[model samples]
Target: MSQRLVVGITGATGAAYGLRLLRRGRELGLETHLIVTPAGVLNVHHELGLDRKALEAETSFSHAPGDVGACVASGSFATAAMVVAPCSMKSLAAIAHGFGDNLLTRAADVTLKERRRLILMVRETPFNLAHLRNMTAATEMGAIVFPPLPAFYHRPQTIDELIAESIERVLELAGVAGAAPKAWTGL
Candidate 1:
């Protein structure tokens, strides 16, 4: 059976990562379960020039911000992993503490509990010790906390290239191979 991935996009500024994941994953034949927060919907419109409905139309599985009844909410649904690209601090705290107020958070919790890969692409500046502590706790629970730090070796020229690189990293940790940039041989 083909692998599945949950893509959760929050209010974080870097929304392109999540969108690119869905687009690229679909091309790779991976089923994507997507969830967008209210603010995320607005961000897409303001940033990507796509409205919430239009964005959802392009996804395999899409749900409202706090919709807990989404199909991916259960662990028996079969998934390779979950990716929260551009994860907000609020959602990060939720996942760290096992708070499942929403389907996205709940799905991440279930992924962690199921011993599956849970990639968190946190996108916030000026983080504090508490944030670091929360990240430490989540890491102990098997969630990969990847802040939106870009790499220079890729020699990316446009913003899209940078975002694609980050999503590619998350996909690697999710066990979805062949998604990362070509092997970096020592120059």
Candidate 2:
């Protein structure tokens, strides 16, 4: 079976990151198991103008955020990694605190316990101490807290290019081999 990656899209602002990740994962032939929180569904439509069904159609598999019994929720199910693109503070706190009230958080909790790669693309700014502490806590638990900061050296000509770069880096970190737009060659 192809490598499986669990993608959790939260209510954070940068919905495009999650969308691009799914598209690229499919292109790279990795099986993507997607779970979008209720807020994530709303934000995808609000930010990307894509409805939940359209978002679901982009991935190899889809699970409701409430589906605690999903395969990905179990550590025995082999998966390469998990990424929470545009991870919201609410979700971050839940994961940091080991609160698995729903499938998304439950899967994250499992990812951590299973010693699997867990990446959180936390999309928030003006960090208060609480956010910092949560990030530190998550990091201590082995979750990569990646904030989608733009790389200016690439001189991206469009927003899509920037989003693509973030997706590429996330994939690389997850050990997924795939094509991404060219990286900076260095001056």
Candidate 3:
């Protein structure tokens, strides 16, 4: 199968999810097309102590957020799905409204228009009505709004374990096999 997943990292707190997703995608032999917002770069450095170069090395292709003409921005690019790990509220709003201001949002819009899988790993807490409405709108338009809530039933002991579970679920939504440390086997 041609495994090509488009990854978008926004200015959310859970930068680790996006980073791990890229690494895991590579390990699974999937071609990762990464696009990180400017604030995503800051969050990666602040939370993961990583830079853009580090991120570029983790994926098959990295596109500038402002590059509107990037391959992944078009539906003809033939990607399996598009995921916005650590999807910020701003990006969510843009996608919800069909706004294609930048490469990330444009790719997400295209993904939705193409009727392909679009997963948003929303990282916001204490959602207001507007946030909930935007999420509802995105879902109405065929986007999966996934919050990175930890599942304690998995018996996660470390931060990495929690993040891994989240990434695994996100990948599952996109129909990709992920490095899930503790996939549930029983109730």
Candidate 4:
């Protein structure tokens, strides 16, 4: 199977999720292709203090959001999966509707069309009707709408632990071997 993983970072609050996923993907030997929306850049800098250059350094390849011609925008690119960590509701709407307005959404569209796993770690709370509807649409189109809610069962002592365990579960859903999250045992 192809080892390529496409990761999209949007203008969501939880930029840490995207960063950790990139780091873990590197450790797992996946060729990571990153697409960060302009707002995503701002959030990464604001949340993680990482500039675009520093963030790009985390991945094997990085594409501009406007670069719809990038390799990952095509279904022929042969990526194993695509994930939008901290996916914005706007992005969810675009992907749900096959808008493909930019490289991130285009790659997601391709992932769906190719029958590859597409996980969206959406980061929003107190959803409105539109958010719920878009999520349903994305799910109907074969996208896994994963909200990055922490699992309290893990009894994480640190914020890092919560983020780490959540990301492990996401990586597992992306089909990464050995990316298992801590299993929940019967109480």
Clashes of each: 0, 0, 0, 0
- Over 121-176, each residue of candidate 4 has an lDDT whose tens digit, in order, gives 99888999999999999999999999988899878999999999999999999898
Stretches of candidate 4 exceeding 4 Å from the true structure: none
| Segments in model 3 whose C-alpha atoms lie over 4 Å from true places | 178-183
- Reference-based lDDT, residue 150, model 1: 79
Model 1 residue pairs with clashes: none
- 37-154, model 3: which lDDT tens digit per residue? 9999999999999999988899999999999999998888998899999999999999999999999999999999999999999988899999999999999999999999999997
Sort the predicted structures by TM-score, highest score first: 4, 2, 3, 1
Minimum summed lDDT over a 10-residue window in model 4 is located at 1-10
Indicate which candidate wins on TM-score. 4
Colliding pairs, model 3: none
Which prediction has more favorable TM-score, 1 or 4? 4
Cα deviation in Å at residue 108, candidate 4? 0.5
Q: Which TM-score value belongs to model 1?
A: 0.94
lDDT of 2: 0.94
RMSD of each: 1.3, 1.1, 1.4, 1.0
In model 4, state the lDDT of residue 78: 92
Q: TM-scores of the models, in the given order? A: 0.94, 0.97, 0.96, 0.98
